[model samples]
Target: MMKIRKLLDIRERSIRYGSVFRVLGKWPYEPLVDFLLVYSPGCDRKSNLVVSTGHKAGLIMERLPLESSLEHGANGISTKWAISNWDEWIYPDCPIEDVFVID
Candidate 1:
C-alpha cells in the first residue's frame, strides 16, 4: 500500500483498463514485496472496478473483498487471467501504462 502511496506522489491521472507498467529503478523493499501496484484513474471519471496487482499479489490493505478475490480467485478467474497474461500486457520500458484522456 505504501508503494502506491509513493506512486501517488507522482499521481498519474490518465490510466486505462488492462494497462501495464514496468517498474523502474529500485523501489524500497521491491524485492521483498510480491505485489505490483495497479492504478486506474477511470475512463468515465468513476471507476467500475478497482484492480489490484494480480491474483495473490499487491498489498490489498484493509479491503477484505478485494483481497479475497485476488487470493481465492473469487473474481471468476479474472485474477488468474491477469497473472497468466501479465507479460502480454507489458509495454517495454513504460512506467505508467494507459491512454491519455483530454478533459
Candidate 2:
C-alpha cells in the first residue's frame, strides 16, 4: 500500500463529470502527483472510480479504486490510486486550469 498524499489543488471544468487533482507527494512510477479522477455524477455517484495520468492527447495511464488515500479538505474529496499501465484513458489536457475551471 502506498502512502496517500494531501491534495494540493483541483482542476474542474463545466463538463460536470471528471476532475483533475494535484497531490503533495509522489507515487512509485509517477514522478508528479497529478491525477485525473473520473466518476459518474447522477445515479452511480461513483467518485474516483477511474484514476489516470499523462497528456490527454498522448498516451494515458489508469488505475482502479485509486489505492492511496488523501487528506480531507474543503477543496475536494481526498483519494488516491495505485500506478498502473499506460492504458487508453484520455482526458482533456494537462495544466487543466488553463482549459478547465478551477473549482
Candidate 3:
C-alpha cells in the first residue's frame, strides 16, 4: 500500500458530506498523487452507494452479502455513474488505473 506523507489541509461543508482534504503522498509521479486526491470532493453527494478508496477490495469481496441486490439510482444514475467512473482532477493526465488503488 502507498503511504500517505501528510494531510496538507481539510475543508468541510454540507455539500461535501464531511471532511475534504489534500494529502501529500508518494507516487511514481507527483501527478499520480494529485489524481488520487480528486476523490475527496465527491464525497458529499447522495447516491445508491458510496465506494471509497480506503475500503479495501479484499474486505468488500469478503463482506458483500451475496443475496443482496443493490438498488442503483436510476434518476441520478448518470451523475452517480460519473463519480464511479471519473478520475480525480489533481492528476488529470494520469490514468485512473494508475491512480486509485482500487478500480
**Which candidate leads in TM-score?**
2
**Model 2 lDDT per residue over 1-103, tens place:** 3222222222221212344444332334254444555543453333442334433222234433322233342222332122211122222233333222112
**Among these predicted structures, which one has the highest lDDT?**
2
- In TM-score terms, candidate 1 sits at 0.20
Question: Could you give candidate 1's per-residue lDDT for residues 50-84 as a string of tens digits?
Answer: 22333424433221122212333222213333333
Those runs of model 3 whose alpha carbons end farther than 4 Å from true positions after fitting are 1-31, 34-84, 87-91
- lDDT order, best first, reads 2, 1, 3
Q: Write the per-residue lDDT of candidate 3 for residues 14-60, one digit (tens) a residue.
A: 11222222223344223222211121224343332222234221111
Off by over 4 Å in 1: 1-15, 29-56, 60-103
Q: How far out, in Å, is residue 57 in model 3?
A: 27
RMSD, each candidate, Å?
A: 15.0, 11.9, 14.7
User: On a 0 to 1 TM-score scale, where does candidate 2 land against the true structure?
Assistant: 0.29
Output the worst ten-in-a-row residue range by lDDT, candidate 2. 79-88
